[model samples]
Target: MGDGLPDLPPLFGPVFALREGGDALARAVALAPEHGAGCFVWVRAYARVEAAVVLEPEQPLAAARPALLAAAAAMADALAALGPPQAEIALRWPATLVVNRGVVGAARLAAPPGAAETAVPAWLAVGVEVRRALPPGVEPGTDPGRTALEEEGFDEADTAELTAAWARHLMTGLNEWQERGFARLAGRYLGWLERDPAQAGAARRGLDSATGDLVLQRPDGALTRRSLRAAVAEGVA
Candidate 1:
């Protein structure tokens, strides 16, 4: 590889470059237990960006959901920084990232399977993938629901720069969560969620303070909740 990803914070450990077609998330997961924490793995795919980082946390697995989500936010922020002005970046609940209302990519989290909610996982991996360019023969606007960075005027953005930016932003996010609180991280994430004014009043949505679950209030005062942890776990599988 040797694209020379930019220098990251000291706490981010070392970068492991994977050849094209390599799975960054799987590599990070396999190396995490041995590397302990802070190791990052990335692959510069032909038309996409993929990367994952290992994390070792003192808190229980349940409480760590916010940290994983923060990583996703960091990735989104990094892309936004490099993307064209008014790119209209937004995040779907839990992990998906959209630009200009088109699905560009998503983030995912993985931990020791069947680990108890209150137990500290041996390791946690946060993975991110973004579409860098449309595949050959694919035309823009062919699928209004899907898009790539190139199609969105992000010609200046590249996988290596995005990888470096993500690391820095993730470090900042983790520090914010530790020093300030999850509320601070949560506010940023909530603000980026795609919202519709038409849904206001008739029903409302918010995040649960403790578990990071999506809480929806119905018109009849009934409440429904969806766990972000469960969402991440499912995505990992």
Candidate 2:
């Protein structure tokens, strides 16, 4: 705890700090059923913000999947505040964070074993990590298509503050989801979502309300759906 990850806001407590090698997602999943909600896991690291939080959803796992979208959008909100003005923060589909068009990091989700799509999950955990800098030998811009906060003019970015902000924003987003509906959260998420590189602007994409799938609407109005469920099965990251 010496590295100074700020204390998370109220409601996120029973904080569990782990070693640099800890997997926030895995640890949170292990703790979820016993801890219930508001359990937090912060993976200690200097070059990255690695953390996860647990949420107990009232809805079924399938319908609750957009919680990942909400988490991603919350991250977008958190990064927007930490980055320099004019820095573009966006999401690539479900939960990948993009800053100034570089792949910074991503959010991933997990549920208890045997949690069915139709049955309410015992608990859901959303984990996120964003790079603060490149590894030792890699020079900036020497590596294309990826970036970290330091290289992107995030001079004021602090992993501690970023972690705090992400949690608070996530709280706010989940609150909005409870007050309004998935549409509200989905719209906010999709607003910052960028088109897939392979099909940029070739179609308009939106989140499926019932299931959090990525729906692409072609100019001709034909629709193609990318299953979020399948994506999660493959890997949410």
Q: Write down the RMSD of all candidates, one decimal each.
A: 2.4, 1.8
| Least well predicted 10-residue stretch by lDDT in candidate 2 | 1-10
User: Candidates' lDDT values, in order?
Assistant: 0.82, 0.85
What lDDT tens digits, residue by residue, belong to model 1 across residues 53-75?
89987788888767667877898
Candidate 1 TM-score, true structure as reference: 0.91
Q: Could you say which candidate leads in TM-score?
A: 2
* Counted clashes in each candidate structure: 0, 0
Off by over 4 Å in 2: 1-3, 198-203
TM-score of 2: 0.94
Q: Give candidate 1 misplaced runs (Cα > 4 Å).
A: 196-205, 217-222
- Candidate 2 local lDDT, 125-161, one digit each (tens): 9989888889999998886899998888888867778
